[model samples]
Target chain A: MLGHLPYALAAWLILWGLYGIVTSRNLIHLVICLAVLQTSTYLILLAIGYKAGAVAPIYADMPAGTVAVDPVVQALMLTDIVVEATVVALLLAIAVQAHERGGSLDPARLCALKG
Target chain B: MLAPWPVALPLVAAAFLAGLGDKLPRRLADAIAIGAAAITALCCALLLAGPPVVYWFGGIQPRSGTAIGIDFAIDANGAGLAVLSSLLILAALFFSLKYFDKPAHMFQVLLLVFLAGLCGFSLTGDLFDLFVFFEVMSAAAFGLCAYKSREVGPLQGAINFAVTNTAGAFITLSGIALLYSRTGALNLSHMHRMIAGHDDSLVLAAAALVCTGFLVKAAIVPFQFWLADAHAAAPTPACIVFSGAMVEAGLYAVARLQGALFGLPQLRTPLLAAGVATCLVGAVMCFAQRHLKRLLAFSTIAHAGVILCGIAVLEPGGLSGAGLYVVGHGLVKAALFLCAGMLLHRLQSIDELALHGRGREVPWVGVLFALGGLLLAGAPPTAMFFGDGAIHHALEAHPIARFAVTVASIATGAAVLRACGRIFLGLGPREPDAPGGGEQDEEPETEAAPIPWSMWVPAAFLLALAIGSAWLPREHAGSAAARMLDAHSWATQVLDRAQPAMPSPPPEEPLAKGLAHAALTVGLAIALALLTLFRKRLPEILRGPVRAVWNPLAGSLRALHTGAVGDQVAWLTLGVAALGASLVFS
Candidate 1:
């Protein structure tokens, strides 16, 4: 029961973020929603690495053969975070450019790409 | 050493080019990127011919049947794709030399990074590593899509592309996390061995998430709305990459994963259904578009569907056919985009009606476009015909996929042929206000062009290479499929350092039937072109029923591909949920 909470929270975060993206009116909001959507994965990665009553992965002062949470997923999460940062930065830049091109911030108003 | 070089070389070049910044001369940047790509392609080609090799990073080989470090599992199939990606990057860089006006400083850097990502994605043995490379490629693509940031269309395209793709990526990561929690391994071979005969809920969900995510990347139905807009907004050089290599890379990943990790029987039906739907929808959309680039983009989607159908069959022959088809379709598609770019360069517009009769100025481009259209429809003696033939031979038991492939070929080919007839030969009377005003005021690549040799040479070269792909050794491709499909040998090669021992490959299918199939499709494409161009002159009986069925469906498809992120995400959410539910029950 205790271990499942983090995963359930991760699921909730994903669904909430997706909902926000689907209902988002503004371009910046949509990008933020994307970021939020990505955050769920980070949580899942961290949750996969987490251990109950376990020490951090660092071993500087720890005794020999100490129990530690898995470190690989933490590393994966860090790389994933970096990826999310770059994607969010790119999307935000595009949003700003879209606004500067005399286009409205509302996605409904942006019809330059329609069939 | 060779395995890592294909990925490492372009990355180093990208870093050096990025550091060069504004001080870097455009020609020098182009030369460096092209050099890196050429070397990468050479390394991949060598790898494809040589024995299978597994290169471990930092000398940290697998211990106790599992890996702790990343590895590149270089095989004929992976290396073949890497080679394709590098060649496309080379072609795109060559085209960009004269295609972009004093562009932003990061253009060459991003292209190199994108190539590096594709190579890494193609070669990586770890699931997590694939996601990282996917991000690297997609980030570069998003930036490239909005190269002209001063325009609204490009920005919208970039945003929608980035958002939908990121959502897909996030789902994939969650799936990876679930798989990790179950087996505690990121290595594909390790995971394959861990769950040898299990079809548990967690694994099923992971497979679904992974499949659907890559399916989104593959631009399958309900997740295909972003592709056309992205292509429409991107520069012509970038369009060559987007259609030629990037989307195909998506299919490659899906096929790789299904063979490596998930070989579930239930997975095939949904995948086949999606592929057929995308095939029909994309072909219909391709025919309906007045935007030339959009038309080509939809054709790519349709071809991707055919390739996906081949892969979903999960047979050695099916995979081999899909592999050859990818190379042929990619080269022909690249050539067609180049021709379109040429027309846009010299004529300043890509709208069918706007450019009508204006192409008389560039007769060579028209010739190339027409040839590409014919080859794309599966004309004989080209790689496409051989590949299409192989796939048809594989699908003898399944008629739906065969029918879809043929119809899509005829539809896309006819659409391109019609555009050619109107634009190049001035066959049909022009409608002044026909819908799909289609990207008016496109900024041309160059103001001064008798069509530079730099531009036309690459298109002619790609087309020639595609034509010559007919002679590719069938045994090599067959052996590649043999090595790829047998998970036991693949895992053994990676985990146990065992010599690779694959079963004898499936027998090669004869090409005679495929030749007839190609001839028929090409003839149908030509006839369809003539009919569409002169449809007003045709009697109502010949055209009326077709219009009744096509107009309503095309209208809805267009409405669905509204280029709106919210609607696209809504479709994605619904599709993924449905896919996941099916997986759970299966």
Candidate 2:
């Protein structure tokens, strides 16, 4: 049960973010919630790459018999990190623009185009 | 290998353009973008002429006979998509010269990067690589959507799009992570092989999440609120990219991944149901929209639903029809948007009522708009007619699906035709629609702006491509379909290369039925247009029931899209969960 903690934690983080988004009023908070959700994915990736008793995945020629964690997930996590940074930056920029132009970042008032 | 050139060249060019932002002349920047797009299109054409090419990254081979390393795999369908995207990119750039007033070096760079991302996403065989390319494409799209950052509408649209799509992407990444944990392979084919016999809940959940992400981008129902706002607020050239290829790329990801990786038939029922719902909602909303770009965006959603129906058939004929439909739809939609752009540029308004009889002076413009409407109606001798006919053939056995497709095709066609009649043929009231309804000021006035040859040329070129394919020998389409449907051949070629067998093209309807279907579709569109033109004159009894049914449905649909970012995000989350539950239980 304890070993499954990462899965539960990742899921909780995702759900927490969803809840935050559903209730959030402003663009900045919504973006922050999205970042929180993205962090869950990173956690999941790290969990997938984790090994119970493994050394860092490098060829130092020091541990011939030692096990190594999967490097692929780490690499994927790195990519995800870069993507998250970009998305957050872009989202923040849009939020700032929204605040400046629309006079508010409240999701309720950002009704520029609707049905 | 040449397989990577389609992706590499555009990246290099985009970097150069972005780096040289103000230093480079605007014309030079535009020329470089056009040249890169043309070369990419040529590369895609050359690739389609040959067999599938799979280029493994970093010289990594299969480890002890297990597939590893990322591969740039370009099959005929992938090549076709790449070609379509690059061609549309080229057209969009060509049109941008006159469409944008000043130097837009950053815009050109974002467009090229978006082009590279699209080509890469279509051709990549690795799930993670697909994710990266999706991010690249989407990031550029966010910037492009809010290119005019001073405007509240565009900024709001971009913000809503960015937040929602980012959430969706994170969900997709989570799905990828789940799949990786379940099966330690990122290569699509290898993962497919690994998960062949597994019927685990985890796998189903992951598939659902991945599909949900693409579905959001594809603007499927419940996940589609961002699309109209984004498209309507975006610049015309950017709208071309959004509607023409970007949305289709999302659907392509869903099709390529599901058809190639999971190979599950359980998806058909859910896909069919969601597709039908999407079709109805798109057509109904399209009918209600007064904004020209919003109307086009809704129709894009509707066509995406139609394509989904074709894909849901889970057969060779369906896949082939889907491929052809995407190509046809992209070309026609881009042309239609370009024409709309011209109207907006000239009159400073895209409101149908305001543009009434306005196009009468430009006979060629009217003809082009009418032709585009006919093409949208699936008129024969256009690729859309053949593609729609193929989808009908695929769904012949499923009566409900067949009926849905018929209604959707006719209704969507009717909506576009109605626009053409009102705006071009002056079929309706000459009075402005809902005076001061906040439609006129959507775009700034550009009076007496001469429609340049550059603007109309790309529209004409895309229109010809959409229609000219219909005049081609049926065998070309047939062969392309056959190639797209033969997943076994694709898998073997990329994996083992032992079997070189190719499947023959599926049988299609005789020319007479296709002609009849085309006629019926056109007739429905005309009838709908006439009805709309004389709606106020209709008998009270006849209009009462129609209004009763339509008012409630439209009201509910509109209420769901409250234009709030939080509301949209909640809906997206619900959609993801709903999709996962349906896939798991079904």
Candidate 3:
């Protein structure tokens, strides 16, 4: 079964990240928790495309028909990373403004929209 | 053939507008956004006019049988959605010309990017592209929700929206990774081919994760906590698009993926259950609201649930019914939000209690608001009426579903009607202690002035479409629904370069049944609304009994929607786990 270790690692990261997000008091920490959660996807994508005993996908220096890790998933992972960066940046910016306006970053204290 | 333009055009325009921010005149920026949306809509309409197309980017043909590059597998349904989104964007931009003040071209830029994302999400043949575009839409939406960030309310709303959705997106990406690892395919058609008759745990889990991600976007129950906050705080123009098209995109992706990759009957139960739960829950919470935007937001959730029900039936009649319902419901929801915006602009308040009888000042908006409620209640010959007929015919095999749909429709409609009575007619007793009701002071987006025709005209235009686009005729709707679900033919066309043949649509939904259901819906909506409006006039004995029974149920139902990000995320995770359990075991 292609070594379930990576899957376990990804699952653990996901759980840990969710736990952080659920328990975090501050908005910055929540955003970071979200980033941590996003990191699990990166790991999963890389693990899926990983090829033990295979070379990198840089075919420029490799012999023809050599086994290499999947370039497609790597490409997807790259795009996903870019997207995560944008998301984290945007969330962080909002957190900053929210802190500025409310003088606090604790979501519990940000009681404007809650029940 | 025209697939890419619908997406690419808006993106390029957005980027251009972003670059020219504040340097260009405001009027020019508005023109650019409006022009771009119009052209993109035209392009989508053109795509709809043709046979299904598979336009590969950079001309990377998969003639050798492996999908090497991204492609757009455009069908009538996808093109129809893209056209709808583009048109809504056009309407929003038109309405916003006089709404915002002291803004750079930022709002226009965000809107155009949002349009691009919506188009891309609608037409893309690849799952990864769907995620990318979904992110594009979400990112732009977060920006729009936070554009001014002048108020604490908007900031709180934006933060919750960003975190929860980004989390959902990551889950979806992981799902994509799981599926890709199993099938070695990214293109949906190719994935379908690779997954031939496979219903393994991996597939189930991936399906659960992916659908969970989309349900978040669709703002289904549990994942729906962020929507009311976002919609309530977002600008009126942005709210129109969010409620009208963006949230619905989530449901579309779920259906599209189901048709393409996993059309197993096992998954149907979970989908239907989720749809019904959202429908009932949204209705209950909608009826218990005091904030007009939040009320409309919850109503959006309720109708989205109804649309999901149609898709869950897994038939052409139901699919097409949902399609027409989406057009009818989404447009009416947008019009209603516009009415709310009008109230916000003219009276500078949206609190149900605070704005009591204030709507008389803006009689047109009040009339439009009440009319939107009537359409929502399934007014005869309206688009929703046809949609309801189709759905009822489809769900005829499931009688309990019919009752559920009926109850949900009545509750949501009556909620709107009751609000109309209170805000416009001053008929209801003002109660202030309801949960999350009438909580925020809306910052006026424009100067103190008469409400402009620019705003009301667009709402009226959208309402006209909502009321009458049923003229689209049942046969054509049936055909479009058939094509939308014809996975085999769609795969053959997209991957093998085969000319697609149209399939026959199901028979028309029985009009007699639709009329009966429609009358019941409207009559109950009116009666319930009037009851709530004049409930105090009821004898003390009846009133006491009603409150004793109703207050606790409504309060408990409303309490579950705590509007906290942590609780929402927790519920999302639990929902995903539950969805996976049902898909895996059932």
Candidate 4:
């Protein structure tokens, strides 16, 4: 059970980040919270696929690959990270523009686009 | 030969278009999108004509290996969805030509990418590949959602959509990881074969996780906050794509996964419960909204919930009903969104009051909106009515389930009726002075010339498709349903034997019942139209309190959008945690 500590920690971080996102009023803080939550999900994924004492897929110390973390999860995580980075960047740019146009980053004031 | 190109071409075109989109002429960019879609549609039609062909990437055998390479399986189901998607994208592209002002290239690029994602999602056989396509679709959608970055609503909506959907993608990836660990395969068909014989708790957990991820994408009850904002904030063309095609992809994933992986009886009850809850919540929410686009968004959620009910039955008829509903709703909802866009372009507001009398000005749009509404409400001749009826019949064996479907149908009908009453019927308080020929003449020349055919054509085409697909032969319809039911299941096998004996008209049966239903539906439609004509003098009792209750509910739902970045994150996190826990526990 202790071996799964990292996975548990990741879960905790996700929950913590969610709490921050829900309670925080600041747009930047919300973005940061989302980033944190996303990172925790990645960590949970990586931890789930982890095999104790296994070397990373790239190392010479891997003992001819007797055991290694599932490479599929690694590849998926890598792709996911790239996707996340792009999304965050685009979102921040949008947020910056919204701030400039609306004169405030407060979500309450961004009602110009409401249904 | 043409099978693989439909999915592959759009992907390649998207990359090329995105790179040269800004550098190229607007006409070239638009041509790139429309041309790619036209070719895709042609390819789908060709595939439909041919036998179902399964193209294994790198010649990997299916259901026997680790699914190292991706597979594109072209069944009737895939072909139908592919054709629908292609036509819808083509329509959206046509609309974009007139709707967008500048950055035509960016618009085209995003549109192609979105199409690529949808096509890839529909065709992929590998579960992991589905996740990848979902990500591509979602990321492109986020980009398009915020494409109009100068506006706060678009920005906030995009951010909310990104945060939630990205997390959804991650959870799905995690579910894939768990499934891989348990089954050692990435292919859906392979996994389905393995999972049926195994009862490991981990498989259930993985299914829950994956379904949660999909539910978020599908905008099911609790995870629906981002949809209204994103759909409402997006440009009209993007809105058409978002509502018409994109949401269906999520439901498609759900149906595909349920049929392929968790067809177990134990899973059916919980799924049905979720579907019921989603329908009730979504329908009630739809009734409360005032903003036309937002109302459409909530209505989408309600309809999706109804689709979920069909999915929960896990029968061929139910699956077929769900499939038809997805296609039908895609067309009708897209048309409604585009109509709303047309109204907004001319009237400058989505407020029901603002759009009150303007319906009289744009008779064609008004008629189309009414048609779209009737279709959504499950009136006959339109596809949703058939789909809804099929769902009702499919669930008849399960009383609780039947009751749920009935309530959802009624709610859906009432919501549509209410919206029509408010928008077309003039039951709501009139705008003190509407713009055309009124005190608002001081406003800039808001009434543009009637919308061009490019904008109207796609919407009209979709309407025609919705009506046509509803009239498809029962055998052809039965086959699509059978494919969805996983023919190997005992439930399906029994249902199959009973199907021929059932009342679905023998092959020799004339088109009389269909035509009669159409006539009855049209008569109801005309009566509603007449009501709309005399709505102003109707007693206040019918309209007043109903609007009063609906306004606050809609307002409160909108008010939940505190615009706080944190709140959005919080909801996303909760959603992720719930998904993760479900996956872990199952």
* Weakest 10 consecutive residues of candidate 4 chain B by summed lDDT: B436-445
Candidate 2 per-residue C-alpha lDDT over A27-97 given as tens digits, one digit per residue, 9 for 90 to 100? 78888888899899989999988998888888688657678999999999888888888888888888888
TM-score of 4: 0.85
Q: For residues B1-586, could you state the per-residue lDDT of candidate 1 as single tens digits? A: 7888987899999898888856777667777778988998999999988888999999999998979999998887788888888888788888887776675447778888898888999999999999999988998899899987777777888888888999998999899999998889999989888877887888989888877677788898878988988887788888888898888889998888888776676777887788888889999999988878889999999999999888878888888888999989989999999998888887878888788888898989999999999998989667677778888888788899889988889999999999999999999888766555334445665674678887899999999989988888877887787677777888989999998665676787766667678889999999999988888998899688989987888888777776778899999999888888888985
Q: What DockQ does predicted model 2 obtain? A: 0.67
User: Using TM-score as the measure, what is the rank order of every candidate, best first?
Assistant: 1, 3, 2, 4
Error of 3 at B425 (Å): 2.5
* Model 1 chain B poorest 10 in a row by lDDT: B434-443
> Can you write out model 2's per-residue Cα lDDT over B212-260, one digit (the tens) per residue?
8788899887799899888888989889889989988988898788766
lDDT of 4 by residue, B39-150 (tens): 9889887876664455667765533234566677555566767777888888878877777655577777787878878888887777888888888788788888887776
Off by over 4 Å in 2: A112-115, B435-441, B445-448, B471-489
Candidate 4 runs further than 4 Å off = A52-69, A108-115, B48-51, B61-64, B398-447, B487-586
* Candidate 1: clashing pairs of residues: none
User: CAPRI band of model 1?
Assistant: medium
